[model samples]
Target: MPEAYATSAVASGATGFAPTGGVQPILSVKHIEKIYGTKDSVTHALAGVSFDVAPGEFVGIMGPSGSGKTTLLNCVATIDTVTSGHILIGGRDITNLRTRELARFRRDELGFIFQDSNLLDTLNGFENISLALSIKGAPANQIAAKVHAIAETLGVSDVLKKYPYQMSGGQKQRIAAARAMAAEPKLVLADEPTGALDSRSATVMLEAMEMMNVQFGATIMMVTHDSYAASFAKRILFIKDGTVFNEIRKGDTSRKDFFSRIMEVVSFLGGDASDAR
Candidate 1:
């Protein structure tokens, strides 16, 4: 690990979007290594993966299946233990935290969105979102305000009262995004969030996500196999064989051009570029 990347304790009273003046990365993966199996047979799930996600940046991780992208995400999300390395979120070294502390840290610092909306069928969109804060014991009076605020930002305010089954896939995804952002987590981790949506719905969901990043200064790290979805990010890291093979920055580029660039890289990486559309 680089000396500059050493883990430090998070500052006290840090909220999810807590301002840091750009001094420290919101999420840091330093020389991470994850291997599966014993000495006799070892599977190198990750090989010296290192990266940083700065505040307010939307980072996309792209790789084909079995490329270890999901493994890396799991490691950062603390759902899987790293064989060797450090994962720092908000300056705290989560890799070393005890079980209870890990649970508490994940609940308080991390927000997650998956391919499935994961909204409770029995609950309305607002209730489904508020349930997260409620579980964290947020003040009852404040939960509604937070839910409404996030729902509005994610363009799901009108659908807040609707049940998941009653809403379209795009609406459900936007609601899920609202739930992820409402708590103001230090980082949002999304795994193929638009995988299940139709092309039109996926476009709407990506636009809403871009709004969340631009409007709320939300820091997001999403893992996707779709080129179109990845183009929405400001920067992208391409992983292959458990290591970063390449990276590209949107850097004032139009989404169409960026999509073209991403497709070129995907083709270079031997991945199917047909997914771009």
Candidate 2:
């Protein structure tokens, strides 16, 4: 495991977020590996990747293209299998789960936010947010309550009655965020959540995600290439050549300062210049 880079023990302004004190990690990726191809040709997408995300902590994974950040996320999300090692979510070994069990585990324990909002074209914001609970056979009132609470927290309540076409990019994304958290999954995985939005919209979406972390107590592991987007995370794990090269925690630093630090690391890692502000 690479040594964590930041000095502070905990994230700055983590008052509302749940503490890791004496608690088991919400997600654990232990020396996991992913490789593809035959004897003559091999691709090491991920090599000995190991990390832990405590309850309510928000972590970012950043690396250059082909650095295996996406591969790592897929392995943790169980969309792709690891070549070796273990992944435990909420104390359950998902890598060893049967096909049926893995399906149930995904629906029950994981929430995903993608680059695109991925909202159903036919469903309005409220219906979209309620879909997960509806599939779980939750009662009408219970589903409504969960949707309302999450939408309100994400500041997307006003758009509940609107369809994706009727909302702004930021609004659509916020509603999508509400849907993911409505199920109150043990962990949320986000991939470039702000990638598709304009600067203003992206800022709004990031703020909503922050609320989801601090207010909703959701543990998130997001994969992003943009330093500005990554600044929102409490800590960052920088991947290089399929391994964790370094780590940084927010500590007492402000988001602006954290962003600068992230940019510095990006420079050191030979990341694309556009990734910086």
For all predicted structures, in order, the TM-scores are 0.90, 0.91
Off by over 4 Å in 2: 1-22, 273-277
User: Stretches of candidate 1 above 4 Å error?
Assistant: 1-22, 274-277
After the best TM-score superposition of candidate 1, give how far the Cα of residue 232 lies from its true spot, in angstroms. 0.4
Q: Counting only residues 3 or more apart in sequence or on different chains, how many pairs clash (N, Cα, C under 3 Å) in candidate 2? A: 0
Top candidate on TM-score is 2
| Per-model CA lDDT versus the true structure | 0.85, 0.85
Model 2 lDDT, full chain set: 0.85
